[model samples]
Target: MSDLGNTFMRRFVQFINTADEKLGEELIAPNAEFYVPFQSEPLVGPRGWLKAVEVMRGGFPDVQWTLEELVVEGEKIAARYTMRGTHEGTFFGVPATGKKIAIQTMNFYAMANGKIVGERGQPDLLGLMQQIGAVPAPS
Candidate 1:
């Protein structure tokens, strides 16, 4: 199961880096749920996951996530990543600053039958905003 989880996560990273819908569909279950920050409703399925990726790409077209660490237990996996990109476009209503950003993110995934069925993610959004000059940094 650990090996399967690792392989699944590797493919997931590839899907996110490329934003390939077909690969996403193959990796994620049809009824998968993703709970994201600041959103009341959970995003569902591959399309929903891709929409989130699109939102990130809207700000950082070259954004990429690197899996730094992974831990698997039963049907669940916890992953830590370093997300890097340039602020080349609008993001969350904030204008582009042409700055580069590298932030950490932690995500947990639940898988069943070799497909991801659920995910809960925590990203360093405040750090990203600060790096992009959208928010003030602490003294």
Candidate 2:
């Protein structure tokens, strides 16, 4: 189970980095639930997940996520990632500032039948916003 979880998380990281719809469909269950920040409703399935990726890419065309660490147990996997990108387009109603950002993100996933069935993610949005000049950083 640990090996499977590890392999699944690797593929999941690939999907995130590439935003490949085909790969996403293969890794994510059709009815998977994703609990994300800011949004009130859970994003459902591969399409929903891909949409989120698209939004990120729209704002940061050179965005990339590196899987820094992973811990797997049974059907659960916890991952830590470093997300880096340049803000080159509008995001969350804020105009681009051509600033670079690197933020840490943590996510917990539940897998079934070798596919991701659920995910809860926590990303450093406040830091990201500050880096991109969307929000003021504290002195």
Candidate 3:
């Protein structure tokens, strides 16, 4: 059942890194729901998913995604991934820091019909800001 979730993640990685919207279409359902903190809108389709990733990559041109752990059960999958990138373009009003940053992220994905049905994106925002020198570390 959830084996589809694992397959989806594999295809997602290739789609995101390559900016291949066509392949992305095959990885997400027509009405997939995506929840991300960075964006106010819940992405609704593959086109939206592709656009969102493009914006993220534009902000962090050297972004790299590293999957550290993965778990699957029935129709759900949980993945922990590390992201490393340089701030090369403006992001949500923050001027480019030109600093390399790493953020630890976890995602829960639900799959149906070999495509993602639901996606929840979570990341360590505080750690990322601190690593990028955007904020001071806790004393």
Give the candidate number with the greatest lDDT: 1
List where candidate 1 sits over 4 angstroms from the true fold: none
Q: Could you give candidate 1's per-residue lDDT for residues 116-136 as a string of tens digits?
A: 999999999999989998789
User: 1 or 2: which has the higher lDDT?
Assistant: 1
Cα misplacement distance, residue 98 of candidate 1 (Å): 0.7
- Report lDDT per candidate: 0.93, 0.90, 0.80
Q: Each model's TM-score, in the order given?
A: 0.97, 0.95, 0.89
Q: Write the per-residue lDDT of candidate 3 for residues 14-113, one digit (tens) a residue.
A: 7877778789787889899988887887888887777768777877887878777889887788989898899888766667889898889998988787
RMSD of 3: 1.8
Q: lDDT tens digits, residues 33-63, model 2? A: 9988968899999998987888888899999
On TM-score, the stronger of 2 and 3 is: 2
lDDT of 2: 0.90
What's the C-alpha lDDT at position 9 in model 2? 76
